[model samples]
Target: MGLARRIAGAVFLLLLLALGLAAWGRFRAPSAAERDALELLRVDSTPLPAKNAWHALWLLDYIIPAGEREAAYAQDLAQLRDRAVAVRAGTPVPPFRKWAENHYAALPKLTDDDRAAICRPVSQCLAQVRTHPEATRLALTRHADRLAAIAGLAGMDYLWNDMPPVTAAPGPDIGDVQALWLTAAASDFVEGRQQEGLAQACTSALTMRRLHVGGNDALGSMITARWAIEAGGLAMDMLAQMPDDAPVPAICAAAFAPPVDADVDFCEVSRAQWRGSFGSVENFPVVEHGAGGASWLLSRDQTRRLAAPAFVAACKADVRAAELADAHLDDAIQPRPTPDFIDRIGNVQGVDLAVAGVPNFVPYLRRNRDYAATLRMFGTALWLRTLKGDYRTLAARVAARPASVNPPGSRPIKAGPDGISLVMDLYAPVDGERVTTVPLPVPAS
Candidate 1:
């Protein structure tokens, strides 16, 4: 009986010790897990959510070619992916999804670097969808909503701040808005929302035009025209859903037309100027000057007749060009020509030559000259002229050109007839080198 009692007591003591150790471990394990969760929450609180996935994918895509040290970063990204899965599975994890959404919504308020960072996680979520397929569809759906919300928030921020101020003066703010809209529309399109993208792009284009007309500056007008062209290009690209084809004018006609408050005559004249100076029309007849000084219209010939003297003469005769020149000549020509010369020219032309506004021809010529150089460099003019004889065709030709033509930090100026000139400067890299050219095309009609 004594032995039995001693054995039982020993067994009881061992059981108690075992229970205590188990309790201690249970308490310590949660503290460690909580610490990790808190650290993750700190990272999630910042705008890093946006950049996490993108950075990871980019690193994975080109780390070796990029010559960067990214192995550890890649591993961290892998770990994050696992944690994100846990969060998605409703494992009582921290509010990573909500945190991401909030961070994304606040993206535009953050700095550019912050915005970039926020994009990363969204990209990773997308990548997850691709690999896991249907198993992760629900999680991806939620992530998509978060991404869309973030995009909407960023867009609103742009509309509020980056949009052109409603001032009496003209500026590039309208163009900036249109650009932002295009970016948003592209995001939507990539997410398989084509119709939504098209609608947004169209609306943005119209808004840009409306804002453009309110301004009085010639530069402002030119800038707005360029925006219209770009918006039209985007519409065509999206509508066609092809890489090579140009968008028909009808697609953008509703958006391109002048608003009710716009000057009808001025707008018509501007459109005509666009047609004459650049191949703004896809199928319009080209106006050619005959040897007898009579003008005749020519159809698409593809004979390199775009540079004919008659075509040049027609461009010179353009009323808008003349008006722009008259407006801006004084400012453009330094040490202004003698008053007598201006008066004599004025008398011959029955207009005040000395009177100047901004020259409309300046922008047109500048764009054309740059177009010519790009055509020469790419050897794509013939193909472009043959495919679709329009401004879109010309733009595509420019887009498809090799990037070697214009390197960084180099500016090229090409001069045309009558002191007209165009300047080309490099922007961001397209493939490997910067593509710098004025967005203009050889007049097709």
Candidate 2:
């Protein structure tokens, strides 16, 4: 009986210890890493320059010696962090300047008619504009300088990013408008400014594709690229049907060419997800008091440690998805489903949640490729419209199928009703026929 009682006492003490640890974890102070991450991530509260290159070859320049890029960055970051802390604690900080501010400030404010005109689809509105050109014309006339300024953005390479919004974070800073660059180009097209509109459209596509903002784990870049491609689609639809064979001007030539595909990467996105995994200390209380939010059962570092393996697994999966992206569009790559064992409802330790949250980039990648191929096929129509050739040459090219524009026997460039339209992965068949019948423009006789 004595031996049994001793064994029972030992078991009870162990149970108490476990409970004590759990309670402490559920209410522990934010770790140094968590504090540092918050300071760095919530950047708008401080005075660092734009996170990326600006219109005139700009990045936040740190003043340390060569071969010490990371060191310089760290030093600058430390100063910035200090300033942020001081400002938040009611201390005076030095004034800061950013070149992007001037450029944005110069943008023409949108008027009611201009906003409404931007909402109109350029292709459908052409006939409407020709007959009743008052509204668009008014917008065009009223905002001529604005139009010019917006068009000039095409010449300047820039990436518009507000960063993966911690807006849901406590006392978050206001974010910039997300789709202004895209909408600006669309508005230009809607207002009947063909040349400038094309230039803007091309620039928007190239900007997103060329210099994709790397840090944020959001698919905003890929999604925005598709939006730009769709805008190009709108352009193609408009140009193909136009009765007049408008010449692709010397300046607008490059804009008509199909844009290159963006390099597929989700590693940075994974890091962002990982970083945000640690719920902010400020917001933790709200989570703790409100519901069964992890108070958390593990410290921030412990949580990160537990979650790192899963993040790596998810990132590796993304890399594989990127490989499959290069394969044929219909190539089947199964997505990694969330592990079944993890409990989401009261998951204090988010071990597999990050892995599950990693987006399936496979579908989006194929769409981007199809859009690129379709744009290339549409490029042929643009060529025929502007670069009319001898009948023999034109007929030969047409007869050869879009092989003149694409490789022989590509699926998307297949023949359509009005000589050659398009068909892609996204295009669905109607009445048992899979085709998009676009009215390819005839060069004026």
Per-residue alpha-carbon lDDT of model 2 for 1-445, expressed as tens digits? 9999999999999988766755554444444544444344434421134433222122222122224433433443455456555644457766643323332333355566565654343334445455545665666566565444333334433343323233211111111111333344444555677666555555655444443433242545455445445455555655654554565544334543543323444344444554444434322212233255445432444343333443333234444344323335333343332322222322354434434443455454454445445456556656656444545444455545434345533444444544435444443222353443334655456
TM-score of each: 0.29, 0.55
lDDT for model 1, on a 0 to 1 scale? Answer: 0.34
In candidate 1, residue 384 scores what lDDT? 36
Stretches of candidate 2 off by over 4 Å are 2-112, 123-125, 160-164, 168-223, 241-296, 299-302, 305-348, 352-367, 380-411, 427-439, 443-445
List ranges where model 1 is wrong by over 4 Å. Answer: 1-110, 114-176, 242-251, 256-318, 321-337, 341-361, 364-445
lDDT of 1 by residue, 1-445 (tens): 9999999999999988766654432233223433332233223112212222223222221213222323444443454555545643445543322222222222222234323322132213223334444433333233443334323322211111111112122212121233334555555554677667656555555544543433223344445444544554454445435233433333245554322223111332232332332222332233336784333222221111111211222123343343322222222411221223322322222112212211234334343333223323222222332355344433344455443333332234332222211223422222243443222233434
In angstroms, give how far residue 68 of model 2 lies from its true place.
Answer: 30
Q: How high a TM-score does candidate 2 get?
A: 0.55
